[model samples]
Target: MNSLVLVLVAIVFFIVAYSTYGSWLCKKWGIDPKRPTPAHTRTDGVDYVPAKAPVLLGHHFSSIAGAGPIVGPIAAAVFGWLPVMLWIIIGSIFFGGVHDMGALFASIRHDGKSIGEVIHVNMGDTGKKLFSWFAWLSLLLVIAAFTSICAATFVKVPSAATSSLLFILLAIIFGFLVYRRGAGLGISSVIGVALLFFCIWLGLEFPLHLSYNTWVVILLAYIAVASVTPVWILLQPRDYLNSFLLYAMLLGGVLGVLIKHPKIQLPAVTSFNLGNYKLLFPILFVTVACGAISGFHSLVGSGTTSKQLDNEKDVKVIGYGSMLIEGVLATLAIITAAYIGQDKLAELLKGSATNVFSNGLGEFMTGFGLPFATGKSFVALAISAFALTSLDTATRLGRFIFQEMFDKRKSADEVSSNPLTNKYVATIITVVLGGLLTFKGWRTIWPVFGSANQLLAALALLSLAVFLKRQGKEYRMASIPTVFMFLVTLFALVLLIIGKMSNFGKNWPIILIAVVLFVLAIILMITGVKALSDNKVSEDKNFKA
Candidate 1:
C-alpha cells in the first residue's frame, strides 16, 4: 500500500539478483568452485573441507543462521517493519551477500585457510591477530548467549534433555559412519538426517527437564566432545543432519504460510523511539545480520567451508545463494510475525521459545500439523539446533584462528606441526571458556552477540573490498559494492558508537555493557586495520584465507 513497502519488495528482488548476478560474473571469469578443494588440498583431518556445493552450503548456512534471523528482526521490529525490512533487503544484497561471496571466493582462491590468515599474508600477522582476537571474542559471546539459551530452555522443558542427548549421540554415530567407516556421503547423510528428525519427534513426545545448572553442564559437555572430534565424524554429520532439520522447518513454514495466510497487523513504522533501541550503530549491525549482513558468514567462509570447494564456480550458490535462502527464511519469519498483535508478540517472546524468533517460528510450525502445547517446545528445540550449530562451528573456527594468530610462520608442512593441538586443545579451550560463561547465564551475555557480530561484519567486508580493489579487473565489479559497503557500514558503526555512548549511564546493565564494548571495538578495529596496512608484504599479493 505504501512506497516503503514497494521499496521492500524491490529490495528483495535485488537480493535475488545479488545472489545470482555475481555468480554469473564468477562463472564468466572461469572460476570453478568445485575444484579439488582446499580441504582436500592439504587435509590431515583437521581442515578436511567438503568439495560438494550443497553440503558445504548446508554447513555454512546452518552455522551462519544461528540467533541472528530470529533475534535481529525482533529487535528491529521495535523500530517498525519498514526500517528493519529495508535494511534486511539492502544489507543482504550489497552488504551480507557480497561480503559472504567475496570471502568464500577469497578463501577458495588462496588455499583455504581463514580470513585471519589471508589478512596476515596480505596485511600482516598483527592484522591477522587483531581480527582473530575479535573473531574469538565474537564466538565467545555467541557460545555464551546460545549456551545460556539452551540451558534456560532445558531448565523449563526438562524432557527436551533426552533429545539433546539423542542429537549428540546420533551425530557422533553418524559422524563415525561418514568419517571412519566406508559409508557413502550421500547414504550416511540420509540416515543421519532422518535420525535428527526422529530425535526432534522424540523430544516432543518424551520431554525431560533438569536444573539450569545441570543443563548448562550437560550442554557444555556436548560442546566439548563435539568440538574436538573431527568434522567428518561430528561437525559434518551433525551439520548435515542440521541441514535436514532446517529444511524441514522451511517446508513446514512455507506450507503453514500458504495454509494459514495470516493477516499482517504490525504498524508500518515502529514508533520512532531511539531510546529503546538498546544497541547503537555497530551493535545494531551485528544484531541484525541474520536479516541483513553478518560477520559470521565471513568466519564460515574462511573456516572449513572454503576448503570444500569442488569448483569456485559454485561459490555463488554456496555463499551468496545460501545467504539469499537465509534471507527468505527471515522473510518467512517476518511474515509470520506480522500475524500476532504487538502486545501478544511481546508476551509470547518473553514466556518461552527463548526469543521472538523461536516463539514466532514455533507458532508458525504449529499452523502446519503440530499441536499447540508441543509448538513451544518445538520452537525451543529449533532454537537449540540453531545455537548448537553456531556454537560448535564458531568454537572450531575460533580455535583455528587463535592458533593461527600465535603460531609462527612456517612452510605448509610445518603448519600442521601441531595438528592435534588445533583440532582438540584449541576447540576444548574455546568451548570450556564459553561453557563457563553460559553456566553463568545467558541474560548476562546475549545482548553482546549483536554488537560483536556487526563489528566483525564491518571489518570483514572492508577487508573483502580492499582485497577485491587490488584485484584490478575484478575490482571494476567489486569496487562499487566494496566502497558502498565500506561507507554504509562505517556510517552504521559510527551511529552505533554514538548510540552506545548515549547509553553509557543507562540503568539497564546490559545496554550499559554494550555501550562500553562498542568503544573498545572501535579502538580495536582501528588498530587492527593499521596493523594490517603495515604488514611486511608491500604488495599485498600473498594471502592465506
Candidate 2:
C-alpha cells in the first residue's frame, strides 16, 4: 500500500470526526458560548488569565504534543502501519478527544481546579487526596524519564544542544518583551521565530559539546525555575513559539509523503511479539498510549490549559481539536517509520524512537530538495522543543498536585500560601526528586511510567464520568472510555510488576514503585466505581420524581 493513502485516510477520518462526532459531543454536553469560563470568572492573572483562542490552543497543543506522539507511533510500528493507523484514528475520536474535552470542561466548571480537585467535588475529599497523589507520582515519573531523554539527545546531537540553549535564551527574551516591555504578540513572535531559525543555523555552524550528565543537571535546573514562574512570562509564550516549528514539521512531513508517495515497506500486521513482551490485546493499547489515548494529556488539559481557557466554546477546539491534530502527527509518524527500510528501522529502534523520526524526516526533506544535514537539524530542534515544553509543563503540574495535596480548600492562593507549599519550593522539590530519579535509573523508570501514564488517563476519565453523571449530562462517552483504559492500564501494571519481581535482585526499587502504582490504581478505580454507582442511583431517584 502507498503510505500517502494511509496519510490521506487518517486525515479524512480526523476531519469527519472533528466536524461530526466532536460537534455532537459539544452539543450533548451543552457547551455555551455565553458561559463565563474559569479564566474570566477567576481571573487570578497568575494562572487564570483569559488567553486568546489561538494562543491558548497553541499552548495546549505544544504541551500535549511532546515526544509521545512521535515516539509511541514509531516504536509501535513493529505491529504494522494498519493497526497503528486504526488506533490513532479511532482512539483520538472516541477516547482521547472525549477525555481531554471532559477534563477541560470539568476543570473550568470547578474554577480551574486540577482533575484531582474535580474528583473531590464529585467523589469527596478522600478520593481527591488519593487522585492527587496518583497524579503527582505519575508526573514525577514523567519528569524523570523526559529529563533523561532530553539530556541524552543533547549529548548525542551536538547541534541540538546548541539549538536548545539558544531556544531557552530566546524564550526568556520573548517573554520579557511581551509581558513587561509591552511588545505586541505579532512583532515579538516574528522576531522570536526569526531568531530561532538563526539559532538553528548557528547550531549547525558551531555545535555545543556537553557530557550527558551535565546536560541532565542543566535541564533539571531550568525546569525548577521555569515551573515556578508565572505562566505568561515563560510557559505560554515559549509554547506558542515552539508550536510553529511543530506545525512546520508536520506540514513538511505531509508534503514529503505526497511528493514522494512512498510505498509502505513494513507489513500490514505482524506477530504480537515486541522484544520480550507480546503486543496482543491490551499491550498494544499500552504501547501506543500517547498517539491514541494518554492519561498524561488529562494532566496537561486540567493542569494548566483549563486555567487559561478564555471561552467555554473554545474547549472543544483546544481539547478535542488539538488531540485530533496529534492523531494526524501520529499517523505521519507511522508513515515515516514504515517508509524507512526494515533494516534501518530496526537499527534506529535499537536507540531512541526520536532517531527513527529524525531519519525518516530527513529522508522526506531531502525529497523536497533540502540537504540532509539541514533536515536533521530541523528535526532535532523540533524534538528538543517538544521535550523542553513538556518538561516545564510537567514540573508545573507536579507543583500544582503537591500544593493541592496539602490544601483542602483548593484555593488558587494556596499555591503560595506557605513556604512548604509555595510555588517556588514545590517546583524545586519536584525537580529535585525527578532529577534524582533520572540519575538513579531512567531506563527502569520508563516501563512503569508508560503504564502509570495510561492508568492516570483511566482515572481522569472516571473522574470526568462522575462529574458528568452528577450534572445529569450524557456521561456514557466518558464512562466507556474509562472502563477500557482502566482494564488495559491495570493489565499493563500487573505485567510490569510480575516482570519486575522476576528480576528482584537488581530491580527491587522499581518493583516496589510498580506495586505502589498498582495498588493506588486499584484504590482509585474502586472509589470511582462506587461514586459512579451512587450517582446513577441518585439520578434514577430524581428522574422518578
Candidate 3:
C-alpha cells in the first residue's frame, strides 16, 4: 500500500467521522451554546480563566499529544501496520472520542471538578479518595516517563533543548502582551507563530548541550515552576504557541507522503505474538494509548481544560476533535515504521522511537525540498517541545489530584488550614515523588505506565457512564468503551506482573506498584458496579445546567 493513499484515506475518514458521528453525539448529549461554562462561572484568574476556542484547543492538544502518539505507534509497529492502523481509526472515533468528550462534558457540568469529583457525586467519598490516589500515582508515572524522554532527547539533539527553552520565554512574553496589555488574539498569534519559527532557526544555530542527568534535573525544575505558576503566564501560552510546531510538522509530513508516495514495506500482519513476552490482543491496546484513547486525557479534560473552557459549545472541537487529529499523527508514525521495514525499525527501536519517527518524517520532508538533517532536527525539536509540555502538565495534574484528595469542592488556591491541602505543599510533594521516579528512567517505567494509563481510561469511562446513568442520558457510548478498556488493561497488568516475577529481586518494586494498581482497579470496578445498580436518578439541580 502507498503511504500517501493510506494517509489521505484516514484523513478523509476522520473528517467524515467528525461531521457525522461527532455531530450525532453532540445532538444526543444536547450541547447548549447559551450555557455559561465553568471558566466563566469559576472565574479564577489562574486556572479558571476563559480562553478562546483555538487557544484552549492548543493547550489541550499539546498536553495530550506529547510523545505518546509518536512513541506508541512506532513501538507497536511490530504487530504490523494493518492492525495498528485499524485500531487507530476504529479506536479514535468510537473509543477515544467518546471517552474524551464525555469526560469534558461531565467535568464542565460538575463545576469543572476533576474526575475524582465526578466519582464523588455518583459514588461516595471513599470512591473519590480511591480514584484520586490512583490518578495521582498514574500521573507520577506520566511525569517520570515524559521527563526522562524529554531530557534524553535534549542530550541527543541539543538544538531541541535550546528551542524548547526559547519557546517558554516567548510564551511568557506572549501571555503578557495578550493578557496584560490587552492585545488582540489575531495579531498576537500571527506574530507569536512567526517568532516561534525563528526560534527554531536560532536553536539550530546555537545549540545548548547538557548531560542526560543534568538535563533531567533542569527539566524537573522547569516543570516544578511551570506547574505552580499561573496558566496564562506559562502553561497556556507555551502550549498554545508550541501547538503550531505540531501543526507544521503534520502538514509537512502529509505533503511529504503525497510527493514521495512511499510503499508500506512491512507486512500487513506479522504474527499474533512477537515473542515469549508479547501478544497482540491486550498489548496493542495498551501500547497505542494516546492515538486511540488514554486515561490521561480524562485527567487533562477535567483538570485544566475544563477550567479554561469558554463555552460548552466548544467541547466537541477541543475534546473529540483533538483526539481525531492525534489519530492522524499516530497513523503517520506507524507509516514511518512500516516504510522502514521490520528489521530497520528494530534497529531504530534500539535507540528510540523518537529517532525512528523523526528520521522517517525527515526523509518525507526531503520530497518537499527540505534538507534531511534540518528536517530531522526540526522534527526532533517539535517532539521534544511537546514532551516538555506533557511533563509540566502532568505535574500540574498531579498537584491537582493530590490536593483534591482532601478537598474537591475548592480550587487549589483557596485557603485551607491543612498543610497538605496547600497548593505549594501539594505541588512540591507531587514533583519530588515524580522526580524520584525520573532517575529510574522512562524505559523501566514505560511498560507499567502503559498498563496504568489504559486502566485509567477504563476507570474514567466507568465514572462517566455512572454519571450519565444518574442523569438518565444515553450512555452506551461511554459504557461500551469502559468494558473494553477494563478487559484490556487488566489482562495486560496481570501479564506484566507475571513476566516481571521471573526477576523477583530486580523487579519487585515494579511488581508491587503493578499489584497495587490491580487492586485499585478491582476496587473501582466494585464501586462503579454499585453506582450503576442504583435505580435512583440524581435530582441535583446542576444536572440541568
RMSD of 1: 4.4
Between candidates 2 and 3, the lDDT winner? 3
Could you tell me every candidate's TM-score relative to the true structure? 0.85, 0.95, 0.98
Off by over 4 Å in 1: 1-15, 24-30, 33-35, 276-286, 352-355, 365-369, 415-425, 439-444, 476-545
Ranking by lDDT: 3, 2, 1
Candidate closest to the true structure, highest TM-score: 3
Model 3 residue 308 distance off true place after TM-score fit, in angstroms = 0.6
- Indicate the worst ten consecutive residues by lDDT in candidate 1: 536-545
Candidate 2 contains a number of clashing pairs equal to 1
Report the alpha-carbon TM-score of model 2 versus the true structure.
0.95
Residue by residue across 1-545, what tens digits does model 3's lDDT show?
89987898889989999999899888878788888899998897999999999999999999999999898888888898988999999999999988999899999999998999999988888889899999999998999999999998999999999999999999999999998999999999999999999999999999999999999889878888888899989988999999999999999999999999899999998999987568998999899888798999999999999999998999999999999999999999999999989889999888799999999999999998999999999999999999999889999999888887876345546677778877889989998888888887887888899999999999999999999888888889888988999999999999899899989998887798899999999999999989988886886786672
Candidate 2 error regions (>4 Å): 409-419, 440-443, 536-545
Best by lDDT: 3
Candidate 1 C-alpha lDDT tens digits along 1-545: 33224335644686658647765656533465345666666766756655466667777888887656766766556555666666777777666777788788778667887887666655555666667777877777777877777677676766566676788789778767666786787877777777777887888788775787887777777777766666766676666677777777767666565556556677767655456344334334444556777778888988878876667667887888877767766666565455575777767667532445555556666667787556666666766777778877877776777777666656655655555346567777788777766654654454456656666776676565455544432433444554444444445545544545654664244444445545545654565446434423235443322
lDDT of 2 by residue, 220-294 (tens): 989988887888877888888888889989988888888888888888887676655555566677777789888
Residue pairs in clash, model 2: 295-457
